[model samples]
Target: MSYDSAKAAFADWGVDTETALSKLAEIPISMHCWQGDDVVGFEAKTGNSGGGIQATGNHPGRARTPDELRADLEFSYSMIPGKHRLNLHACYLDTDQNPDRDEIEYSHFAPWVDWATDQGLGLDFNPTFFAHEKADDNLTLSHPDQGIREFWIEHGKRSRDIAAQMGAALGSPVVNNIWVPDGYKDTPVDRMEPRQRLENSLDTMMATKHDKAQMLDAVESKLFGIGVEACTVGSHEFYMGYATRKGTLLCLDMGHFHPTENVADKLSSVALSVDEILLHVSRPMRWDSDHVILLDDAILQMAQELVSAGLLDRTHIGLDFFDATISRTAAWVIGTRNMQKALLRALLAPWDRLKSAENNLDYTSRLVVTEEIKDLPYATVWAEFCDRMGVPSGQSLISDLHQYQAGVSGRG
Candidate 1:
């Protein structure tokens, strides 16, 4: 069970444990900021988190201020191995000015950029299309009224600029993702008009483009949400065609598909058409419950697909779960670490051997080797990775999490 023994075992299968660890360290997962505050952003005029967006639980130590959230993020990142990026929403702007979503400027988020710069972290951005008056009807860009649609359009445009500024400041490209809750609770009489309106709105909003090095555009799709059960305007097909035509990244949220769907399978299919991909990795308990991810089959398959298809370079992995039922900081660390673990497992797989078996139609060898590798000291290798990355594993990790919870228990 020792790391040395595990390394030798993997070497016998034509896998290099050192190479796997090196590759895992290079991949950075973008952690969502909303998890710290239960998606109740620091906006002055925040509305109900409608549109199927709700974080359940009354866990103590929910971050209430920008500073507190940053502190919590700092602690979470400390426990997670390797460098990572922070995914920020426009509503999380840290500023004294009370700006509406459409009126938001880079100045409102300058503090976050400064903090990220100091911490040596990259930044990703999302335009807050929900939790606002305009989104009360579960529509924004696809709103029937031009005035309502324009309001959201302006917000989207402003978000791109802010993301570009952040990316420029950090000297890295920021992924500016757009996800709208435009859908109908009941079946719509006509879906065409709304989609057409959304298409036009997107065209107008993305007319002015920043350098790709500063910002990359991504459009996220959803199957359905709480009130929008009957219809989701930004379905996978809608955004897949849009992203393909517009040459923008397509965001495939794990929780945004049918319960039985395997999102990992879509990576290779979508990659053929789109230049880049953005993944909002999360766990869905029957629905888009946004549960903190565990090292389960779904995650393992996702990581395996990324590794097998050679999609790591073109894919951006980001965590998008907000669970307030536990220590918020711990939720971030656990989910992000699980994602890292999945990638590490995938990296250590004897991919070449498996592929050769499959290519030769050696079904028995393929099946046997795949199942046999499951018992191969993966935990031992993972522990070595944690140790090398200066993070705790096993009981030590649990103790650290509990200590953090006790420290923040007085948030009430």
Candidate 2:
């Protein structure tokens, strides 16, 4: 049989074609993670480099025009849905330096909609801001550079217009997600200025929308590193407490913590509207490398806790990572697998047992973390069971089950 036919036959016997194809699709995926070249806003910038948008010099990486972007989307869909949840750093666009160029270059949001529709991928917009702007409580914009500041003011209008257009095209609110990288460095530099302007701009933008759009404003808080000393919305608890109070929800990026920090406890401490907590998944580590790790049991346990606490429901997960040396497709496939594994472990957890313990106040203390999922010292049984079910351990979870079935039938 041909490869496609054989693959179909295997799938007919209950193999997961999506998982298998995702593995092979990684080979041709381009490495464009943190380069910030992909976001629609970054397109307005003048110069490009191997890394991403720059101030003056030309970017070396293959510059994709609107047509090229559409083509890329087609290619990606043919292979598999390229990661829909996108995280673009705000500083990459540098609102302070080249606001006009950034806006001009990034006006390709319309084409992005065409591609997303063709591919059947949901757009989770994450415009991560690294600098601060000042807007009056009335939502009037302000900034340090008068020229660029005015440019940003206009850029906001352009962005809203693009979003409205895209929303109409998709028949859904296009401005779906927002995450602010605003916080203090050393001491509070902008103090309340950053927070005030960001909120003001968002409130104004939301008011302009003709239809209702679901907004998940991930107020991420940082510990220390880069120029960030105190993150504006550092932890889930912090975001829940602060952003929810400001009438915005939270987005929790897991990688923003030390090993010792109790992920569940920290999550619990945030007293706010349960809907305020939105989960953004990634292995916990510093900002050094976005290496995706296995979704261990700890994360599963925490997920269970969030579910019990009503903090997470219908919240989409973001596979956030950036490694230039690896194939873009491969990184996504691996990251997706890791994420899936964590989710599976969460699904398979002894929920009944966990819930019962909560009544005794002992459950929270016994909650598992991702670390436990890593050292599955007694995973031989589970692995064997998976093998017996014909689940493809490497690429196809279903193929692994099929192989197990064939082996069992042969033995019988």
Best model number under lDDT: 1
Q: Which digits, one per residue and each the tens of the lDDT, describe model 2 over residues 305-369? A: 65456444434455545443433333344555454444433443444555565767775544652
> Candidate 1, residues 64-143: lDDT per residue as tens digits?
99999999999889899899999999999998888888899999999999999999899999999989877888889999
Q: Which stretches of candidate 1 lie over 4 Å from their true place?
A: none
In TM-score terms, candidate 1 sits at: 0.99
Candidate 1, lDDT over the whole model: 0.93
